[model samples]
Target: MNAPRLIVGLGNPTDQHASDRHNAGFWFIDALLRHYPGQMRPDTKFFGDVGEVRIGTQVVRLIKPMTYMNRSGQAVGALARFYRIDPEDILVAYDELDLMPGSARLKLGGSSTHNGLRDLTAHLGTPRYWRLRLGIGHPRTLNPGQSVINFVLGRPSAADQQLIEQAIDRSVDHLPVLFRDGWEIATQQLHSADPAMQAKKEAKSSNPKEEAGEKARRRAPEDA
Candidate 1:
């Protein structure tokens, strides 16, 4: 697969949403700017802040849509069309509620519940673009009574934010590999680096008989 040429980070505009969990994408972009030699400038034409950075031989463009989260497509589509960039050459990073904090996943061509992504797809006319799902966690799992809108628009707890920051840093570090080595190698490297995921895998790999015995005991009460 071709490496991405344009990377869009989905988030709301303004200082108000800066630290919100919904701005995880913006946080990733900030982290990327720290790692790469680039500076963002406001581009009225694209309706967002745009920047460029060299990743090895390729020149990659970065965008943080100022159109806010729900209408992010307005900015992304403008940039993509002007550059003649194919959907395959675009990668969008945004928050994911389904994933736990500190965990991230990279995938291509899938539907999402995110309004930002949905609007993006409408503009691009395809869902084939790559996506970097940064986990901010879901309210349903983290706080049973909280609504998703409030949870995402709100800031994460300090502990959760720390984990999310680590994930962002890891993702940003993997971009060079993604640009030079391609998706498979980059994805594997990124996913493997997630400590929480590794721990879960290790737990699952423990003694099967012991695990089975525990499951059996739990089921015994139901069976009785």
Candidate 2:
């Protein structure tokens, strides 16, 4: 059998950080657990709780590093080494300030000013891991002295929290599809606007009178 894949959710482990914007990664994992219970349990060696679940014939391990966001690499590194899993097989989920709320993007790439990813690359010595980035829009204005930290660590307003939670739910639903199908197919299914697509199809099936009127308008100009 193939070695299990690791899905690590990056976040700080503290009551204070539980609902913070920076902890969106953990929020996703929490939502996943709610959807599929009894798949994970606490494992102290990883410096966090670890859970295992089977999707088809493949077993995927879910991890939440206990170390604070900046030091997440340590816990992840330890888990990867113990499991003998390659970096490419590891999937990480985290929040991205550049993306708008209630939106998410999945890609495999290098760290981009993301402290968690930076430290992770430093420990793993590679930047080839998969990532699911949850969007948490940037603050309207900048503040001095650890402003970035404050912005990420702060709790979101009620409306923003609702949006983030909705995104999390969608992300969790997409995970099973991701494992069952490939990324491209799963992404389209998850991100595509179904209602908008239906509307477009309906518009194409306009009344016969409207189509006839449009044809008459075109022919009138030619006749003149």
Candidate 3:
């Protein structure tokens, strides 16, 4: 597979949404800009903030949709269609509620209950693109009776935010592997470094109650 030509960070584009868990994608993009020499500027044609950075030999375009979370695809679709970039060569980074904070996954396909991803697939016409699922964790798992909408739109706790930021850094560090090597190797390298995933595995193996809680958490609805 070709190295990704476009890397999109899915998030609502407003100051109000900046620290929300739903803006994990934006946070990742910000982190990337810090590590790689790049600047984000608003582009009307793309309906988003667009930028680029060279990784190895690949010039990867980065986008942060200016549209709200539900309409995320509009900006992505505009930029992607104009560039004639194939869906397979696009990577989108967004938050995930299923995994615990401090864990992230790189994978292709599967939108699950993520509205941003669902809209992205609708516009891109396929779910074949790569994804960086930065785990924000579910409210039901962390705090009982909290609504999904409130949980996602609200800022994460200080400790959780630290974990999420750590996860973002880890994901950013492995981009070279994803672009230079391939999905299989990158997935192995990325997943192997996820401490949260390892902790979850240990909890599942040693504590049935914790495993059951995890299952319930997955089954809970993510949208309001």
Candidate 4:
């Protein structure tokens, strides 16, 4: 809704977890930093690596939590409190297992399967912040016996990884629209399947929840 917002990318902070599906948040931020080239430095005070980038004069602080995935609240809560940023002024990006790989959805509120989100919601004492859920897909879809923990901690196949990266790449183009024009514009432009149909589609909805629900269309495992 305003400038100088905090954009947190969630992930574990270790080399071993670097390429795991659970680290999709890290990968998303990595792609962003590569595109925008922020001069990120490890900030002990923030308990994470902090950096800034100006998109048409709006300063967006990009943060990669160093507290690991399970304890993201430490870094996120500290940074937001220090900066006096409201919960609505923050946007978090992370992997989602329920959607197909190469897909992405931006919305507000909680997650069903992400521990990082649960930690964040707990620390913030609310689920009002925005979220960019990058689909990494579920490994159990391909194998019934695969454990969700093992699937997320394990590295994705090269093909799946590329798909996830591409999804992030496409989603990155809407960062400016999201920060400047807010949620509706970001969702309409980014989530719509066809550019020509976006305006017509947006005209059909006034509620962000309805819009996100209709557009996001949460997909669960058929067997589950």
Error of 1 at 17 (Å): 0.7
Residue 23 displacement in candidate 2 (angstroms): 0.5
Clashing pairs in 4: none
**What is the C-alpha lDDT profile of model 1 across 124-179, one tens digit per residue?**
99999999999988998898899999999999999999999999998988988998
What is the Cα-based TM-score of model 1? Answer: 0.91
- The candidate that achieves the highest lDDT relative to the unseen native structure: 1
Off by over 4 Å in 3: 200-224
Residues 26-64, candidate 3, lDDT per residue (tens digit)? 999999999999999999989899999998888999999
lDDT by residue (1-224, candidate 4, tens digit) is 55338888998887989988888888888888877858778999888988887775677888889998888988899889888889888889898888667778878775455789988888888898988888877867844689988988988888888878888888888777776787888877778743224555666576677777765555434434
Measured by TM-score, how close is model 4 to the native structure? 0.83
- Could you tell me the TM-score of candidate 3? 0.88
Give candidate 4's root-mean-square deviation (CA, Å).
7.9
TM-score of each: 0.91, 0.79, 0.88, 0.83
lDDT of 2: 0.79
Residue clash pairs of candidate 3: none
Q: Candidate 4 — which residues are off by over 4 angstroms?
A: 193-224
Between candidates 2 and 3, the one scoring higher on TM-score is 3
Alpha-carbon error at 68 in model 1, in Å?
A: 1.1
Model 2 C-alpha lDDT per residue in residues 1-224, reported as the tens digit of each score: 12229888888887978888999998888887787754556677887779876666677888998888898898899999998889878889999888767777777776589999999998898998888888887875432354777889988778778878888888788877787777777667766533333454467467777767767898998899
